[model samples]
Target: MSIYLCISGIVFSVYLIANLWAMSSNRLNQPGYVLTDLDGLVGVRHNSLSRLFSGFTTLVAKQHIRRIQVSSECLTLFTDADDCVNIWLSDRYLPINANYAKVLFPQAEFVDSPFLP
Candidate 1:
């Protein structure tokens, strides 16, 4: 009986330690879609029109912007059918302000807008 009790105590301790470690190291996967901790969208009429983005889907904002900046460079650029909105990227991979982050693949542009799609 003592032996059984000792073995159970050790197993419980190991399990608790493993769970704590996982939490500390963030090994636990979060649900996809969490975006940011910034203020939500605001409108003139004070209408609720935005959802909080969070979780694993935050990868959407994880762009590897390197070397150049679009605001500094006026280089004209285009998007693919998927409209991932890549960097303007001149011949030398220079950055351009294509503003692909805000624009969905074909959200506003495809909706009879003179500026896009």
Candidate 2:
């Protein structure tokens, strides 16, 4: 009975340690994990599958990005051919810094962006 209790205690301790490690991980702070101003207008999160497709697109991609526009709550990337990708700000990520945005996206225009404080 005593040996069984010791084994259970060890198992519980291991589970607690693992849970804490996962909770404190910095995965969300990475470039592709959470959108940040540092990524500029061209940065998009890439998983394994998306990374493969992105490589192919970069190889034969002819579309040229014209400008990026930031509004109070959304970011818009414009291409020379009228194509665009929009990202909306939410509670999922922290607010963006204005200085980084300007530095990263030199061609970007802003319109009363609340996130750029």
Candidate 3:
């Protein structure tokens, strides 16, 4: 496994420890993740995959590595019902993001996403 996977695992594990174990405060007040701001999400298409991957890694680390009151993780950074998503990528690896997207949709239309948001 890569260091990124290790880092993510550590983060969720710690969250389980503090929350499920009741060793810490309410998770809503001390979220393990954060929502990246609109600025961070805007024009996210880096010139290279390595750059995009590295940037995402940094963002995740910055968000989950800390224990804060306001987690961007609680925020929904994007609602692209009116946008055209042109992901010009050669490979795919969104880690836990697929779960988020799948949970957000339930057999939704693909060709014409009238409710993409």
Candidate 4:
């Protein structure tokens, strides 16, 4: 009985250690999206796992972009097809500015509108 208890304790310790390491390394595979600058196009990337498991379903082309609107909460991208993509700004994503817009979408007009969209 003592031997079984010792073995079970060891196994539990190993499991706890593994979980701690995974949490510290952020390998738990959280659901989130990242925007990648693809020169002329903006790629919307989903999933933080291996690229083979991830998907880029939405791609915003530079030439097709009608205008770029920035608000206090988020940045909106208007396309020629009347579709708007909102990229919410946070402290992690950095503050919005004209230089940042130019670097991200150089061809599109950056509109600093008061409207919150």
Candidate 5:
């Protein structure tokens, strides 16, 4: 039982370390959409695990965005079809200027969304 607990602790620690490293790296800004053009229907590409895991299924097949919506806690991008990408403001992948998202997406409806703890 002690050995099992030790192994579990090690695994958990590794997971936390990896997540922190990824977050501190700022990998999301590598390549993809710009905040200014997002409202104009420009597509943003992000491959970060933090942002990707937020709503991966909706965005996996979407390459182009037709609409952008910003709430207090999340940013949702819609494809031309029915797909969408959702990014939580609390995620490290999110740009520091995330507050500007609301200004860029003025028509976006405000809603309650999930955030990282």
Candidate 6:
């Protein structure tokens, strides 16, 4: 019916607008750090939505990071015994390679968080 068509058109328009905004904003350009036992990865790009909500709090030191934890949704870098830097990841913007991380931190823990980007 005309009513259904109208609704579908509105939904499509909204989806298109949101996708364009995300692309234009380059939503994964925030600086992040990756840590491993033998080597450290720094200056990685993080999700823009995560940075916007969490803000930058801790500065990770390459020498201090002890472990790296990766999950489907996020990457957590631990340092100084207890400190952690949580970086959210998006499928559209994967700044780091998960396979490379796995090779670097073979014994690292993987956890799932109840958050989405």
TM-score of every candidate relative to the true structure: 0.25, 0.38, 0.20, 0.50, 0.45, 0.41
Give all candidates' CA lDDT scores.
0.27, 0.44, 0.29, 0.56, 0.48, 0.50
Candidate 2 residues lying further than 4 Å off, grouped into runs, are 1-41, 46-63, 91-94, 97-99, 113-117
Candidate 4 lands at a TM-score of 0.50
Backbone clashes in candidate 4 total 0
Error of 5 at 28 (Å): 5.0
Per-residue accuracy of model 3 over 1-117 as CA lDDT, tens digit each: 699999999998886665433322232212112123333232222112323233532222221221111112221222333322232211122223223323333233223223323
Q: Give the TM-score ranking, best first.
A: 4, 5, 6, 2, 1, 3
> In candidate 1, how many clashes are counted?
6
What pairs collide in candidate 1? 33-54, 34-53, 34-54, 34-55, 35-53, 35-54
Candidate with the greatest lDDT versus the true structure:
4
TM-score for candidate 6, residues paired by index = 0.41
Candidate 6 lowest-lDDT run of ten: 29-38
TM-score of 3: 0.20
The positional error of residue 94 in candidate 6, measured at the CA in angstroms, is 4.8
Query: Which of the two candidates, 4 or 6, achieves a greater lDDT against the reference?
Result: 4
- What ranges in model 1 sit over 4 Å off? 29-117
| Backbone collision tally, model 2 | 0
Best TM-score goes to which candidate? Answer: 4
Ranking by lDDT: 4, 6, 5, 2, 3, 1
* Model 2, residue 7: C-alpha shift (Å): 36
Candidate 4, 11-111: lDDT as tens digits: 99987776444333322221123455677776643222221234534677878877877676456778888898765443234243334555666678878
109: Cα error in model 2, Å:
2.8
Model 1 lDDT per residue over 1-117, tens place = 999999999999987776445333321211111112122321110001111112212122222211211332122212333333222222221211133322322232322223332
